[model samples]
Target: MAINRILIANRGEIALRIHRAAHEMGIETVAVHSTADADAMHVRLADHAVCIGPPAAAESYLNHAAIISAAEVAGCDAIHPGYGFLSENARFAEKVEAHDIAWIGPKPEHIVTMGDKVQAKKTAGELGLPLVPGSDGAVSDPEEGRKIASEIGYPVIIKAASGGGGRGMKVCESEDKIESLMSQAGSEAKAAFGDATVYIEKYLGNPRHIEFQVFGDGNGNAIHLGERDCSLQRRHQKVLEEAPSPVISDEERERMGEVCAQAMRDMGYRGAGTIEFLWEDGEFYFIEMNTRLQVEHPVTEAITGVDLVREQIRIADGKPLSVAQKDLEFRGHAIECRINAEDPFTFAPSPGKVTYYHPAGGMHVRVDSGLYAGYSIPPYYDSMIAKLIVYGRDREGCIMRLRRALEEMVVEGVKTNIPLHRELLHQKDVLHGDYSIKWLEEWLESRED
Candidate 1:
């Protein structure tokens, strides 16, 4: 069951992150990259490199057959689909398993259950997990959507059954906007998931983005790895995240954690997963379950010292968890800021050659960067260039490290969110850890100063 040789089914920082961890454990890593990334840092850092296909995702990252063949040829025992592309693709997970290769993720069934929002909520309810009152199935009729909304009460959210990146969601304030919003939501969902089916759910008022990290050994053992605060977001995408949510009390944390762990067990989930929730008025409502290692796992690693991907590989290989829930300890706070290659003000991708790249480094300052000096920032995939993770004794101390990191970070010839992060740290509410989901957008607009 030892994953001595692994094929990283991804690129960029995540690939390099997995590569470093594997090397530390004396594991050999084979990095798979697109044509554009043949000379990328991940390729150079891996023990071996393979070019899957062209630059586009469909031909490269999402091509399951190609990836499996590459792994087989390389004599790899496992494949780690870091974050995006086929990470959450249930079909891809199944294909990997068919080849007798360890799929470093939850079971394919778990992915399908969570991929569809309506089915996920129903499953949660069946497992005695908290759920915001909503429809049991997709509403094909606008009238049906409104009727369900009336039962649940307004500010209802129309969501795509298979949506991501906050793309196919519409908030309806009243019955007047219900029809138009449903049409828009359905259209967006159809274009995105290839399934036009949409669902209705009650929207919580000013809720915080809270999620529990859990690990299942494909057996009866499932343990919660503490919670993370991801309330600082933009357009439903997280910008900043911290471990040990600042708002939740110890009692509340235990309750939420227990429920999430039990819920995952009820679904017969296997491997590493995240159960996201909307926490408001001290009540938790199931948001969705992420079926792979999350983009924010470094924060959890900083606090718990647990290598999540490593655990995932073992779990998939039918091995038991190394540590028990009671044996683990979260002794500190960690914060992560996503640095995207974009115009600070316009938020548009600014892809080009990196004139200079200086990553921040110091005590408790860990940076997972995908770019190096002169690395080309292609527009093919996400613009996220680096993740700056800072850890400290407390939240305030972590914030201080983030400030210093931002000040020291220097990426020339490419606009970044560094300047915006500087202004964000200075904001009174942000510094006090009392910001909402719209904190960044609203703050940006108010800078009419």
Candidate 2:
């Protein structure tokens, strides 16, 4: 596989992440930057770098034309959209493929199928995979949503057919709420997705967020790397992520992974992807699929010792999975805390220059950051500055290590969610791994009370 040079179509930590991996794999890397990121850490470290556009992402990272042009100008053979921006865009994937440049991710069809929530669910259901009872496709009217909700039982979730990260979701408990919820959800989806199509599903109350990591080749074989527990979240945005959910039984873990791999195979899934689920009342429901590397992929890598980026390249080159299910072994525990540049209490964005910087370091501690001393946190991008990943023999040990790492971290100029993470780690419920998706929000509300 001549995966010699790669152009990273992203910014921040993910760009730095792929750069580090490619460096170790003997692959040259070019970092694409915006005007605000000329002196950014990723740009400074790459073998070659170029400014793709202005500060705003819509004209920069999301601008597929500029990224492909950058790759061509730099003579890069492949484009790796690390995570956000055009990472999961089917049109972008097709555009890169049209240039005869390798897209270091899943196929465009996989991206399209998985990117649409209702279509993904229908496909999964066809494969006999367990899915949450919901509308088969996008619903045009509130009456259709009401019919589906009635059939699926009450307390259903109204979500945008083409949405994610909780941007266009509303939970309606009664038929009365469905009218208002449907109108609101449709409006939000129209604004967010440019498609007013909405869908309904029975909402699982107090469910745990778990997802399986699956990788595949274009030839159709794939295997799972196990599961990650992302139950600790706020506004459906993951706050902390850990591998091998502490609450899941071994049997349940195997069951989920096996079915997820099968589902991917049936869908002709290739490259890195994630199958998200909500487990409650001893049942697992395949919710939606992400046809790209996840933001929380590092925790899985820490436990499996697999460089997913390298695997993505090998698969894209038409090589089958080298590791079989029988050969894979997961050891230890890993946890990731997103160190965002924001207020710990208010949870608002805090964008400014870093006056001072001191990142944590110790055995089994990995800090993936794109910020440095005097680097400004531009208001145009995501507020996350670093991902503090820690691995240990077990979850308990990992917790202690995280506490130590949090104590050692010092971002002097800007406030961060470090205090919130500190308090969350010490909570008995979170410590015991008994929290749910709503735990963080409820915990904060109770703290206020």
Candidate 3:
């Protein structure tokens, strides 16, 4: 059941990341790219490359038939859908399995269950996981949403069942605004996910965003890889992530880790996944479960010394996990900053030719980037250009090292968010590890005045 060759159904750094891991494991990689990404680093580094379609993602990256055709033509045994695009698509997973090709991720059923917010909460509750108080299903009517909000208290968040990355969500602080917010949420969800269904959930003010990394071997055996603090976010999208959450105690970590591992086993989940939670008042409330490898996975690898991509391939091949819970141990702290090709102040996309690119390098400093000098960043997809990961003996050391590494790094010709990251590192709250999901947006707003 070993996979000898894999087709990367993605582009950019994550595609390159998968290729590097596969190469180290003696596996061949076939990179699939759009016409605009013909010169992408991942495509160049792969053992083989195929042009799936034109510049538009709908005709290229999101076209399952084209991707399957490419994989079959390349004689690949598996497909690795990196984060975004088709990563969490259950139908795509089922289609891959139908084509007799391994999908290096969770089962199709698992993806369907977790991709929907309401269903995910139900499953979590069935697994004995705590959930935020709200409607048990999609609220089809405004009156229903208002009623649920009354029971859950004010400041309720309306979320799309299939939403992620901060889209299709709205917060309503009073009954007066419930109807309008619900309509907006449903419309946004319909446009973004092709589903107008929305759900209501109690919003925790200033709660910290924490997520546990879980791995399963598809035989009901799983283990947790500690937790990561991703409270520094903008519009529900995580900007920075750190392993060994600075706020949680050892006792809390062990308790939460065990719960997440048991939940995975109960769900019969396979492959690598992330169980996100909102931590407030020393309690945990289940958020949605990410059915595929996360963008912030590098920080987990940095602290645990595990090659997650390698593990994903093995797990997809029906192999058992290499280490048991008792054998796993967390090491030093690690931090990751997402470097995006955007206007630092306006957060608008600034895609163009990267005339100069110099990545920082030092002990415990890792840069996972697909961009190179003279590489043109296409304006057709996500703005993230690279991930800067740094590790140290402790949180303080990790922060210091990350700051220095960011300082050493350089990219030219396209505006980047490096300036924003630099300002974040120097902030008193961030330096003290005292921030929540709402903290960054508020801080960003304060910068304007």
Per-prediction count of colliding residue pairs? 0, 0, 0
Whichever of 1 and 3 has more lDDT, that candidate is 3
Misplaced by over 4 Å in model 2 are none
TM-score of model 1 (CA atoms): 0.97
Off by over 4 Å in 3: none
lDDT of 3 by residue, 191-261 (tens): 99899898999988889999999999999999999999999998877899999999999899999999999
Assess each prediction's global lDDT (C-alpha) against the native.
0.87, 0.88, 0.93
Between the candidate structures 1 and 3, which one is better when assessed by TM-score?
3
| Model 2 deviation from native, Cα RMSD in Å | 1.3
- The segments of candidate 1 whose C-alpha lies over 4 angstroms from its true place after superposition are none
Locate the minimum summed-lDDT window of 10 residues in model 2.
313-322
